[model samples]
Target: MALNVALLRASFEVVATANPRFVHRFYEVLFERYPQTRPMFPASGMARQEEMLTGALIAVLDHLEDAPWLTETLGALGAKHVGYGVTREMYDWVGASLLATLAEVAGSAWTPELNAAWTEAYGAIVSLMLARAAT
Candidate 1:
């Protein structure tokens, strides 16, 4: 399925503007819901991790239409993640946490359309990452 780029960008921008703690909220939800994943991250240096995630999200959104670049980048990223002990199942948990965080941040602005847009976008991203991780 195709991603709703416009909706994704607009909603992301709104969320970013509305919540300065976007990434923090994501980690909070993630750890709260999937405590098993908590050990994967360090207690300190989380600011750097959060920064990386924000950068990655921006890059993915910016290059959503660039399949070749997305594949190559995410492929390498996926392979790297494998080294970091990221299991394929963790992606689903992350996706759920991401959507939950976004919905929470977006508050009244969140809608069914935004949820579907992010769902499709995250699914595509994970599919690429997993495909390369399997290699």
Candidate 2:
């Protein structure tokens, strides 16, 4: 869990270093592939878009010390997203696309350590969220 937190922090640092062009590229690639997610975002701008991504990175990193807290937070996040028409299936798409973007940005710097950490972290996130949905 600590490693997962470190990875989230490290990945966000890499992402934050990117120019705005990279953000646009990421959104473009994601939305183009899954047009259905477009409506979940602001139709007119990227303000909330940046917040959501940045917030998720920070939240995940900040909560690594407490897996239960991470699970709870992600459950709330999932519930909110559900209101936006984001289904459980959609989370899988989000994970894939976000990881792809990270890999693209990190290039050679993306190692097994980071990959495994993020994978485990995201798994926990999704599991808790789905568990919440069942409740």
Candidate 3:
């Protein structure tokens, strides 16, 4: 499943300006929907965490065309996540929460086509992450 890079980038640009709030809403939705996952994050330094999340997303999106770098970087991230106790099943929860948050924040800019593209993109990301973790 190929991603609609243009749409993703454009929509992200719209959301990026409110990154702190966006990240806050993302975690709020994630924890509200799946309370069990809350312990995975620290109680403090959320600002830093938000920065990391947005930074990572931007890096991945920017390097989407660079397969080698993307794979290597995501692989390393996946391995690190494994150490942090992130399981394969959790990826689905994260993806759903992420999409929901994006839709809510994107407002009218959100469309079925954009949803499909993000779904595909997230799936691909999780697939790579899981594959790397398996080793």
Candidate 4:
């Protein structure tokens, strides 16, 4: 299914004001659900990682129509992840954690449709990442 960009963007805006907490919640869920992945990140770089994640989300959302830029940027990010020992399987864990965090942050605003949209978007991103990794 195609991404519901408008819905995803609107839902994101609803939780944008709580970005810091959202990012924190994301990592909290991710680590809690998949403790094995925790070793991949350093304790000292969480703040910077949060900033980069938020920035990357905004960049991806804003430039969703720019396929070339998105592909290059996300591919580069995927290539970088290869050096960090990120496996393709980890993408599923991250995606689930992300959706859970979004639901927690969005509270009553979260719906099945919104969840599906984000899932689709995340799948697209992971596909790009995996594609890059395969090269």
Please name the candidate that would achieve the greatest TM-score relative to the true structure.
1
- Cα deviation of 45 in candidate 2 (Å)? 2.7
Q: How accurate is candidate 4 locally (lDDT)?
A: 0.86
- Comparing candidate 1 with candidate 4, which one achieves the higher TM-score? 1
**Model 2, 98-132: lDDT tens per residue?**
77777788787888887777777777778877766
The residue pairs in collision within model 2 are none
lDDT of 3 by residue, 29-128 (tens): 9999999999989988888888899889999889778788878888889989999899988998999999999999888878998898889999988877
| Model 1 Cα lDDT, one tens digit per residue, 30-121 | 99999999899998899999999999999999998889999999989998999989998899999999999999999999999889889989
- Tell me which residue pairs clash in candidate 1: none
Q: What is the TM-score of each candidate against the true structure?
A: 0.96, 0.81, 0.93, 0.93
Which candidate model has the greater TM-score, 1 or 3?
Answer: 1
**Candidate 3 weakest ten by summed lDDT:** 12-21
**Alpha-carbon RMSD, each predicted model:** 1.2, 2.5, 1.6, 1.6
Q: In angstroms, what RMSD does candidate 4 have relative to the true structure?
A: 1.6
Candidate 4 Cα deviation (angstroms), residue 49? 0.8
